[model samples]
Target: MSHTFDASVLREYDIRGIIGQTLGPDDARAIGRSFATLLREAGGETVAIGYDGRMSSPMLEHALCEGLTSGGCNVVRIGLGPTPMLYYAEASSEEIDGGIQITGSHNPPNYNGFKMVFQGRPFFGADIQKLGKIAEEGVWSSGSGEVTERDVMGAYVERLLEGLSGVDVGELADLKVGWDAGNGAAGPALERLAEKLPGEHHLLFTQVDGHFPNHHPDPTVEANLADLRALVAEKKLDFGVAFDGDGDRIGAIDGEGRVIWGDQLLMIYAEDVLKNHAGATIIADVKASRALFDHVAALGGEPLMWKTGHSLIKSKMKETGSPLAGEMSGHVFFADEYYGFDDALYAGVRLIAATARLGQSVTELREAMPAMLNTPEMRFQVDESRKFAAIAEVSERLKTSPGPDVEDVNATDGVRVTTKDGWWLLRASNTQDVLVARAESETKGGLERLMAQIDEQLSLSGLERGESVGH
Candidate 1:
């Protein structure tokens, strides 16, 4: 059967779209066929499949299985779980030749997509574009391949819990915790971990609902964290935790209802790991706070700033043999004593273990970190075709009329200018038609100045500097 897919559905990172609209069973099947064919051509024989808790995932999984089997690749369905579980399965199973995760990954619940890995490397960028072209041209090779169902959840949970065996959680005996899963795929995994944890645990939205009857599953957005915050405050809980749609990223609120951004979480995790792996390399994306890098350096660990993207960060980690790496979006990769995959469940366990060892509350740990005022990620809409050009314009302007005594300028991801007071970054989004900007300083006034610098640059690029643009 011939199937058609919108060329735009194939994204730089993965295939994603709103179900029944840009995506459906047919698209899933076609994607499965194309992906399977790509894998087979790359010498892959078996592929692992897993899905999130979205209502559409099960049907999508079945359709994808049909396509994979028809494309001459055996499918090992790992049933329902987070994207990380699929990554774990691929890393642990020797028979598996590749894997595909059916997940929207913190996007709206109605959205669903795939994250593919072939031959142990992320199958992204040009590979994803190729799949779309194949589907559009109705190019698929036919072969008879078998399909098998497997219950890897039990083993998956066992591996996760087993990694925590040495961690001491005794200090958390008196801690009162609130967990909000936002009805994503992480609910079950968080519930399982809660059962084994020692504390007064309260769960919100633990049931899986693809409709996302509550707020969106993206915890990084401050608005999405409102419910978790209220719950923490109402219960006077020690801390609150939330997960993204696929459970690979995590968000947390201290006892005082303060959001501990991912960079802060990385600081805490870095300190813990540095003790064991002294002088080890720790990586964080350029979007992360400077404080995280400073903290890592102060703790005697090498801090490396790299490009944004989970797959990009993972590849850098492997190249540098970094023990830990995290993105501001909450994707935490731990290669110290575990597989170098971003697993929020494992991150939570580590956080719990670290707090227990500190004998202090989550708020206390936040207080210990250096204080810096940071603007929330500001995103402004731009024509998809003009986004990169805008960035280039700003870069050229900065190069010609450089700011006063700019200490350093890093254009690794975009333009990150560091001055005496603070730093500011402006980058074009890879997934959307938006320009992202962020500024940070030790003082509020300095932050404003840094933002003003960004505004001037934007103005030079013929971009409007309005509040609606978000500063």
Candidate 2:
């Protein structure tokens, strides 16, 4: 039978929507049928699936399993866990050909969605759009495939611990750190990880609760990190690391309770990863700080700036053979000694190991970074039809006029303009009807000038930087 999905749920990266209203079991079933058909056609027979702690997750998972089996795809149910655990199960298995994780990924409790992997590669972009077409066409393969449950959490935790393989045990023993799971899907995995970790660990909200009782699970927003900062301060821990709802993205605080932003975290990872793989190519999103690129270059590694989005970055990592890559949104990917997927839990372990190996505390590493003034990612809602056009308009204007002090324009994903004062970025968010803007500078006056350029660009596009939009 033909199925129709809410157009909004078919996003650039994953299928997502507010529960009941924009999405339901029918859509999940349709997705399962469509995805399974695709996998089978690509010479795959089995698909691994997992879900988060959301109240509606189990229902969706069951429906999805029904659809998968009907489409002649065996289902390996990994039960409740973070997205990375599902990735781990899929990546570590020789029999599993694809995986899907039912997760909202730092969104509100009312929201839920799915992230998929196909043949060990990200299943997104046109692949995500193809699901909608297949569902509408009602061309799913037919069979009653088997379904079985598997517990991969223990094995997943063991793999994460490998991030600290070479670090001195004595140094890790002296470490004291705080972790705030924020009552998201990462809670159970975090608990299991903390138990095995040698450092004195203090955890907050490790009990999985999709309602996000303590605070929001998104660590990118400083406001959501308040609880984590307080925990670090109250306990006098060495530092703190937090996971987003599905534990694919990370947010961290130093010993002094200073927020170590995503790009800053990459600087640390780059330094550590560069030791053995000197002159390796390191990748970061266009939104990352210039300091990170400069730092990577200083460390004798090639710095590559890429478009944002985890799937895009992961694909790029494979294309370029990059050992490590990160985004300003805290999605860190390590292919050095592990699978090239974003795993916040593994990133936290690497943070511990990096500090130990770098011969510096997290606070000291933060202190070593160059001080640059920057604005938090500024997101303003725009009409979906107007978002990309606005960026295009800005790019077209810069090509001809380029105004004063415009040095270079890199339109990799959007337009990043470099000027003497600093640089500013204007891009349309692929997942939402919003235009994202950010600016950075070494001097306060320079930062103000860079921000003005952003405002000027927006004005030229007949748009004002209006009320900030929430992710």
Point to the candidate with the largest lDDT. Answer: 2
Listed per candidate, the RMSD to the true structure in angstroms reads: 2.0, 0.8
Could you estimate the TM-score for every candidate? 0.95, 0.99
Model 2 clashing residue pairs (backbone) = none
Cα lDDT tens digits for candidate 2, 347-465:
99999999999999999999999999999999999999999999999999999999879999999989999999989999999999999999999999999999988998888878999
Q: How many backbone clashes does candidate 1 have?
A: 0
Q: List where candidate 1 sits over 4 angstroms from the true fold.
A: 1-4, 169-171, 466-471
Candidate 2 vs. true structure, TM-score: 0.99
- CA-RMSD of model 2: 0.8
Candidate 1 residue lDDT tens string, 396-435? 8778877675788888898999988789999988887788
Task: Report how far residue 423 has shifted in candidate 1, in Å.
Answer: 0.9
Worst lDDT 10-window in candidate 2: 165-174
